[model samples]
Target: MFERFTKPARAAVVQSQVEARRLGHDRIDDSHLLLGVLAQEAGVGARVLTELGVGLDAARDAVAALHAPDAQALGALGIDLDEVRRKAEAAFGEGALERRFARRRGFFRRSTGHIAFTRPAKAALEDALRQALTLRHNYIGTEHLVLGLLTGGSSTAGRVLHRLGVRVDAAELRRRVLDELGRAA
Candidate 1:
């Protein structure tokens, strides 16, 4: 999954994990993943979210709303938050001990390493990269990344983007990308 990510994208995942640890979060959630995606600063996913006015706080709020105990909030949301946490730990390594040390020292860990990503986010990134490869794109485009985010299926990010009016129809986005590339050429 990590192999498909651009260096910046990978860094963003790492950055999110580190940020979560600094915040004393035990699990890497979708909110953390969205923040990490934003931290990348140069991906289509980030740009699309930003253009749709989806800020980090807004994304966090959206996630929190869905996290309610009410099962009726979303029918068949189908995400195992615990599994997501485990995947994050596997991908980015556990930070519980490191975070504790930083807290004790009255310092925050801002150094970037292999920070974890929530499972949905990881799946989204991987799917997006796979789509890009299928299309024979030399570089992963923002649209590709956005589509990847969508592929995670019923995610906080997907729901929030829909509510914010960011449409990500794969064919349309791909056409736009091709058009832009053609114009550039």
Candidate 2:
């Protein structure tokens, strides 16, 4: 199945792992895959998303927000993250989060090298293959990947894409991606 991936599709897969690591996530979710597609600027996936007003940075920010440390729930308890960070930084001299992680590494530690793909992410990849076969495409491209994400409507990536104002739910995103692919060809 991987052998059928085009250059850009392959890049997106690799980028997804990189994105997961960069975001401090031990697992790669569908959102990471979408971020990877967005990172591949020359890919039709990125172009289609951009045309729909979804930029890579904005997507990254959205994914990060989802992983944020329950700020809203904590705020309900009158615990302000910003204020906590500020106070911690003032006492610790700066980069308090970094220092905390460094301290944890000295004692509590595990293999941080491997990032497993969450079930939804794996399903998206499988769906990409199905999409390619359904479309009678010999090779799976970034467009197929976007279709896969769209098909997995419950995935974090799908939700983020929709929230970012893409027309994935309405089924127009596939058309936009195909249009971009056509123009690219």
Candidate 3:
């Protein structure tokens, strides 16, 4: 199945793990896959997302927003998340508390290496192959990857893309990607 992936598609898969690590996530979810798609600037999926104003940084920020720690939930445990956030911000500057793993001294304690892909992520990759087959494409490309994200409808990546697209919902994005592929063909 990997043999069917094009260069850009393979890059997206590898980069998904990189994005997960950068975001302090142990698992690569569909959102990370979306970042992988956005990272491939020359790929059609990347270009289409960029045209819709969804760049890599913006996508990263969205991922961060989605994964923000729940202060109320933490407060229930008597942790006083707000106070911790304030002190951490004062000592480490802004957004220090927002990160998943905190650094002690110079070392990050969390496992920064070997990120596993979540079930949804694996499903998306499998769906990418299905998308390529449906389109009668010889190789799976980044465009198919974008379609794979949308196939799940309520997936993390689909929701993020829809939110990022603003006026254009996930379905619209799916259409635009397919249309762009058609034009390139």
Candidate 4:
């Protein structure tokens, strides 16, 4: 399922798997993949996601919704929830978030053919993943990616978010969700 990815995209997938394992997770969920992409810091997908308002917490919510069990009381609704998830996954894969940044960065490299993400971008991606895991989310989504871009701060993605007016506060959103869950419980 992952063969269509380029070298950097493949790296993102590998990074996502590593992150999932580090977090003791067993599956390569979308959120984990999102985190993996962001880990590259300079990938086209991460930059595009950051440009959008999506962040780690919002991504978590979306993924959590996907993970939520179907309501037994909604039997009459007759909705194919699995199909919905599959569609969402397909959409995510087709989006700009799945592209590699390595090719983009390669344009500026010296003759040695060595290029790396700026430090801030790398940190931003790591922070995004940490924030997502801290919230106990099983999958990485667009939001986490946005948060990583913001946290990575001062990159093209971060600048794009500022231009788009997306807030970069993952913790606040997490707290609010927890509060809501507490109330529901």
Candidate 5:
């Protein structure tokens, strides 16, 4: 299946891993996949999403906002999240929490080479293949990936898109993609 990916598609996949790592995630999820597609500024997927007002930086900020600690919820437990972060950073320097997991134990040891995909992410990839097949395409491209992310119901990407004000459904996004393809052709 990977062999069927075009260069753009493969780059998106790689970019997803880079996003996951940047966000300190143990696995890549649909949100990361969305980021991957959006990172491709020239890809049809990115162009369609941008037209819908979802750009890469904004999407990344949304994803980070979603994963950030719930200060309001923590307040109910009498915890001051901001104070804790400030104190921790002051005590150990900035990015102290991040350094804990990212630190290398030995001179030769480093972070793992691979980060696995979450179930939903794997499902999205599977759906990308299905999308390509549905479109009668010989290979999976970045556009198919965007379609898969949109159709992966209740996915993190869906939530991120919602936050980014992308109200279009999968069908709508698909139409836009086709239109873009037609223009390119």
Candidate 6:
């Protein structure tokens, strides 16, 4: 499948790993893949998403927000995360919040220095190939990757796209993709 990927597609996959590592994620998820795709400013996928008002910065913010603690929700109730953390640390000693939120170091920890792909991410890549085949394209490009991310319903990337008001339904995304392809051609 990788052998058929165009240069931009390969770059996006590689960039996903870099983004995952930079974000302190042990594994690359759909959000990381989307970030990778958006990083390619000249890629067809990036251009299409940009046209939809979902540029790199917007996508990055969405992914970062997903990782962020639900502080805003608490803030709505007049609770301050920082204030609660300060109180907890004062009573329980330093690093109280870190200890509380930290998971046990085991399976979730990276066994190797290399970041691994999450199941949904792998599925998206495979789906990219399927997308290319479905379109009767010889090469798997970034556009196919975008399609995969949109159609891979269980993925974080798909959820983000949906949240961003991009149509993620199969028919709608396909139509938009074909329109983009027609324009590019």
Q: For this target, which candidate reaches the highest lDDT against the unseen true structure?
A: 5
Encode model 3's per-residue lDDT on 1-185: one tens digit a residue: 99999899899989999988787787899999999999999998898888788889988988877877877888889888778878999999998754665466997775655677889999999998898898788999998898887776578886787667645655776788888887887
TM for every model, in the order presented, reads: 0.55, 0.81, 0.78, 0.32, 0.88, 0.77
Task: List residue ranges in candidate 2 displaced over 4 A.
Answer: 77-108
Model 3 misplaced stretches (Cα beyond 4 Å): 76-78, 82-113, 167-171
Q: Is candidate 5 or candidate 6 better by lDDT?
A: 5
- Enumerate residue pairs that collide in model 1: 44-142
Model 3 lDDT, residue 112, Cα: 53
Model 6 Cα shift for residue 95 (angstroms) = 10
Sorted on TM-score, highest at the top, how do the candidates line up? 5, 2, 3, 6, 1, 4
The CA lDDT of each predicted structure is 0.62, 0.83, 0.84, 0.50, 0.89, 0.82
Query: What is the model-wide C-alpha lDDT for candidate 3?
Result: 0.84
Q: What's the TM for model 2?
A: 0.81
User: Per-residue lDDT of 1-185 in model 5, one digit per residue for the tens?
Assistant: 99999888899999999998898886799999999999988888888888899989999999988887899999999999889989999998998666424344655333577888999999999999999999999999889999998886899999999998889877888899999889878
Candidate 5: residue 68 Cα off by (Å): 0.9
Encode model 6's per-residue lDDT on 57-140: one tens digit a residue: 778778877876799899999999999989999998986655412234543332345676888898988898999999999999
lDDT of 4 by residue, 75-184 (tens): 45876655655686787654332232333454732222222334554565566566557657554433444455455435544443344455646455445434443554
Query: What is the model-wide C-alpha lDDT for candidate 1?
Result: 0.62
Best by TM-score, which number? Answer: 5
Ten contiguous residues with the weakest lDDT in model 1: 95-104
Which residue runs of candidate 1 sit more than 4 Å off their true CA positions?
1-4, 19-25, 29-31, 68-118, 138-143, 165-168, 173-185
Runs of candidate 4 with Cα error greater than 4 angstroms are 1-114, 138-143, 152-156, 164-185
List, in order, the clash count of every candidate structure: 1, 0, 0, 9, 0, 0
* Ranking of predictions according to lDDT: 5, 3, 2, 6, 1, 4
